[model samples]
Target chain A: MPTVYITAPRDVAPEIARTLVEERLAACVNRLACDSVYRWDGEVLTDEEAVLLAKTTDERYAALRDRVVDLHPSEVPCIERFDESDILDAFGNWRAESVGEG
Target chain B: MPTVYITAPRDVAPEIARTLVEERLAACVNRLACDSVYRWDGEVLTDEEAVLLAKTTDERYAALRDRVVDLHPSEVPCIERFDESDILDAFGNWRAESVGEG
Candidate 1:
């Protein structure tokens, strides 16, 4: 299994996280509430957002990406993936146990 | 090995990343150059910084942490770890190969 960090608007994050979790598309989705400031179209934009750091298996990524894109508010959502080796053991086990038999 | 995100001052990120990689404490470190705004000492502080999202193994974490703490400039550096399964296969493979016999 792997962990991925997914960032989206707070309003839409929960919906996307729930859909993925219910489908077992993700082992678990840890939601972090934060204020984000970034640039788009040469304009500095700031907003309240929830970053969904989802944990899932490698096999689940494509489906996860597709579902997130469909459900996300942004036309181009930030669905970045990172390697999972850095996770602590307890957290890793929790994430693994949350998903399919891993 | 696992991927860990180590956020530090730009002046220090590369030093920490390099030391970890050269010592084989981490497989590879991806340097993300960005501006960071965070609260500390009851004050809002912002700075141009670099975040080192280092990749290493579960077994290597303790040693890596010790080394990082010894080397980091901050009194309490951000040595956060996350699950790495979200990483693309190619990146995962690269990270694995960069470390010990993975």
Candidate 2:
């Protein structure tokens, strides 16, 4: 299974999450409040952010990625996909059903 | 490289994250506040939780998993490993250095 990780500003996290679920791009989206420190424009910056872990499968990844980019607020959002060797069977089934025909 | 995802109670999140980094099991830990819905003992429950994303490498996964299990509060903690096909080179180098010699 593939889990997509996306970091967005705190204020827009919920909306982005809802869109993914409503559009059937993900079975579930887990949101976490985080303090992000990274380099940009040759300077290190720290900011409060929200990380969304979207549960999907290999088949749905492309569509999910496209939808996320469309709904994202940042011009170059941090969108990354992760592959897990072990995923709970029940959760995996649910994800497949949620993103049907993706 | 591997990113380990662990879910802990909000109260213990910071400690677990700090321990992983301080002990060099992970280069960085990103914490997120989350609402988890899962099944336990034949009942479905929802609770406030924290998700920790630990950045490390393949060589350190075993030790990191063992140490996380030792330090975790839950009897069966949610410790899952994720692999990314695309990791930024700079971040990957930093992770490799942080978890030196596994």
Candidate 3:
């Protein structure tokens, strides 16, 4: 299975999380509130935001990104996806079960 | 080679990140300002915090944790580590090179 962790402005996490799950693009979404400091344009500023770690199949990644962007509050939300191997069997099974064998 | 990632509160990220890299416990650190929403104490409250993703070797994980706690601002900073496999050869080599072999 592949894991995609998206970092977005805090307020929009719940909306994005609910949408991904309801749409079956992800099996589960773990949301966390945190701060982010980075260089945007020229200046470095710190702000509070929400983090969403979403578990999904590699096949569904593209669709998930499109959906997330549509629902995200920021213009360029951080959407990073990476390949994960040897995932816990129980977690992988749960993810498959959540999305009905997807 | 084994790879590990740590996520910490936003503000404490820089302190922890700098400490880990300087001490040769980590190869590289990615800092993001994000929001984390979770059950703390008895209620779910929202807060602004820095997010840190530190890349380190498996051997150094224990010491890294101890050092991060010593400098972290929060009483209980979130410290979670898991095995990461199929890492890019370049990245793994960079990590090893950073800490000078293991």
Candidate 4:
């Protein structure tokens, strides 16, 4: 399983999260308030962003990433994969059942 | 580098996050509102929890995990490691400099 970290505007975060679950692309999604600081065009910039942690199986990861990119507002969205090395056994099974071939 | 996933009581989440950054155990921490559903004591439990995403280097992970265990209130805290496979190059360099040698 891979947990995807995607950042988007705060206002649209809930919609994106809801859509993922509704479409069964993600088992569950967690959104957090994030203050992002980055360098853009040779200047420091900061923005209030929402970070979405989407849980999905490896079989469904490519689809999840594609859907995210399709809906994302940024031209170059931040979609990073964080591989699951340690997770609760029960929770892991729950996620596996929640997504894919459903 | 690793991004550690931690869950803590909402009220205490800030304290745990602050300590990690202040002590240089983590380069930074992101706290998000998480509604967790799990089976506990043969019953499904739903909790309003805070999820902490702590970013740190491989060299500091052991110390960071030990410190978290020491400071955490829960007997068995959820301290899972999510290995970073994709990340912005500049941000990766920044994290390496932020912890474990200063």
> Which is better, 2 or 4, measured by TM-score?
4
lDDT of each: 0.69, 0.79, 0.67, 0.81
Which stretch of 10 consecutive residues in model 1 chain A shows the poorest summed lDDT? Answer: A36-45
Model 3 achieves a DockQ score of 0.09
Query: What shift in Å separates residue A53 of candidate 3 from its native position after superposition?
Result: 0.2
List, residue by residue over B3-50, the lDDT tens digit for candidate 2: 789999999887888777767777767787889999999999999998
* Candidate 2: tens digits of C-alpha lDDT, residues A1-102: 888888788999999999888888898999878965443343334578888989888888888888877888766666667788798888778779988663
Candidate 4, A1-102: lDDT as tens digits: 688899999988877877776677787777777899988889999999988888888999999999999888888999998787766555567677667654
Question: How large is the i-RMS for each model, in angstroms?
Answer: 10.2, 4.9, 7.3, 4.8
Better of 1 and 3 by DockQ: 1
DockQ of 4: 0.22
Query: Which candidate ranks first by TM-score, i.e. highest?
Result: 4
Among incorrect, acceptable, medium and high, the docking class of model 2 is: incorrect
lDDT score for residue B62 of model 3: 82
Q: Candidate 1, residue B56: CA error in Å?
A: 20
Q: What value does the lDDT take at residue A3 in candidate 4?
A: 84
Assess every candidate by TM-score. 0.50, 0.59, 0.56, 0.61
Better of 2 and 3 by TM-score: 2
Worst 10 residues of 1 chain B by lDDT: B84-93
The 10-residue segment with the lowest total lDDT in model 2 chain B: B86-95
